[model samples]
Target: MTDISPILEFLPCPTPEAWIEEARKPENLAVILVDHANNELKAAQSAMAIMSRYRTGKFGQNRGTSHSNEEKVGLQLKTDDQLSLLNKMSRLAREELRHYEQVLAIMARRDIPYVHLGAGRYAGQLSTAIRTFEPFRLVDTLIMGAFIEARSCERFAALSPWLDDELKKFYLSLLKSESRHFQDYLTLAEAINGASVADRVAIFAGIEQDAIESRDHHFCFHSGVPA
Candidate 1:
């Protein structure tokens, strides 16, 4: 068997005890499963946005490059900063697309059908948040990515223990990549800004906490408190 054990030490995880207890309850299994499906959807949507805005031309279709993996070709980068931002965002988008593909494969194995639901609230909010700053755009976007990935890592760690062997293995398998993705975003944010991102971190931390804690009609990976 491939060793896919999580690098638990590296994750900023929450206490798993509560999550395990809650997840094992029969009523919560469906919730957890649905949430996982929603997570895949959100990730793919985020990746699409990154490709549409950061990679290709913001206005017209750039042509030729179509798939999620084509980062270097067909995209006309405007500036060095844009190029750098595109590279980082493209990397993230690719990873997210892979995550979506992986989860869909899992769903297929389990015979689960994922319906095409519209975008969730947190994603909409984050989309608006990304448009406000010019120079800070890339850093802000990266920080947002970090926050989302970190929280996903935290949640996976939290919920893993309650899952069955196969699910537990899958959830735990997600930690390393998710944690590394978070770190990558943070690193890019800091590197681009050339200063401590403490204040910005704190700001987005609050926003993310609110995004996670607020009640939402739809439940996704980043959905707020249960409605």
Candidate 2:
């Protein structure tokens, strides 16, 4: 496996040590694994949502336009950048879905029944900060995606060594794709915004950090300090 040290540097916020310590407990393993599977599915759905909303600009246009004609016209009107974003999000969505399946297979082997848990407050807290404007809203969304992916990668790295052999191998195998996903989101955000997203990225970084460090009543894959 490739060294993850360099890639870890790119993350705006690191997973807190307290959270990782909690995650590494044997009693928490089953819940952590189940939540992780759910997270993968959610990530795939988020990517698909972004692609659908921005791909052909159909979602952005006037409500009077017929759906069929809007799709046709939107395709014709799509800019090269929009096409690129669509392609990247498509690939990302597929990868996340595949990861979701892999996690489920692992769960099956371990006899851990899949359970749907309420989502942690981490993402919802970040969503509150998203700008309501058209392209800025999109930019904030992409930046949020970047933060989520980066934090996942960080948590994976932090938790891997403490896991059992099978889990260690699986988590290590995921680092590369998670790393790429963060970069893809960041790159697309900057490209779509036509300017450096450094300031905006920093802003989201602080928000994400707050979410990570805050006291959370529930424990899930992306949760903050365990209550």
Candidate 3:
């Protein structure tokens, strides 16, 4: 098992026990898997978005459209740092998609049909802390990624004991990658800023802690205490 102590210490607080109880309920199992799949897709999209904006300097302007690799964009990577961002985000996105596929496979086998689930305020709340500028905006996004991945790792560890053997094994298997992803995002954030992001990280931690400990009607993978 991956060592989650560092990740736990990094966060402002732990996931509420009430939320864990909600998650472990048999009725909520479908909701948990579905939301987890959606979250994985969103994670991939987030990484791709970062690469498009920072590496290619163009995104969202050509939605649902495809362009050749050589096509010109607002900006292109001209530095090693920029290329590094591209490389890391590319790998992260691929991994997230793979996770999504794995979750879908599990859902299929379990006969849990994929269904619509609403978004939780956890991410939206954290995203509000992101600045509206360039370099700082990217850094803040990366830090948020770190927080999300770390929380995922923490929750996997917390929930594994309550799950059936199959899911328990699966979630446990994901810890190392999730932990690495958490560290990668933090490393990228600091690299982008050319300085330690401890201050920026602290700001998001407050928001994350509130999101977790607050009363929430939803039972999302990242939702707060059950209302």
TM-score of each: 0.69, 0.88, 0.90
- Say what the RMSD of model 3 is: 6.3
- Give a tens-digit lDDT track for model 1, residues 127-147: 456634333565577777777
What's model 1's overall lDDT? 0.62
Per-candidate alpha-carbon RMSD to the true structure: 8.1, 5.0, 6.3
Clashing residue pairs in all predictions, respectively, total: 0, 0, 0
- Which residue pairs collide, candidate 1? none
Residue 49, candidate 2: C-alpha displacement in angstroms: 0.8
Give the lowest summed-lDDT range of ten residues in model 1.
1-10
Clashing pairs in 3: none
List the candidate 1 regions with Cα displacement exceeding 4 Å: 1-31, 34-38, 44-48, 51-87, 117-119, 125-131, 214-218
RMSD of 1: 8.1
C-alpha lDDT of all candidate models, in order:
0.62, 0.82, 0.87
Return the top candidate by TM-score.
Answer: 3
Residue 29, candidate 2: Cα error in Å is 0.9
Model 2 TM-score is 0.88
CA error at residue 146 for candidate 2, angstroms: 0.4
Give the poorly placed runs of model 2, Cα more than 4 Å off. Answer: 3-7, 58-78
Q: With candidate 3 superimposed using the best TM-score fit, by how many Å does residue 60's alpha carbon deviate from the native?
A: 13
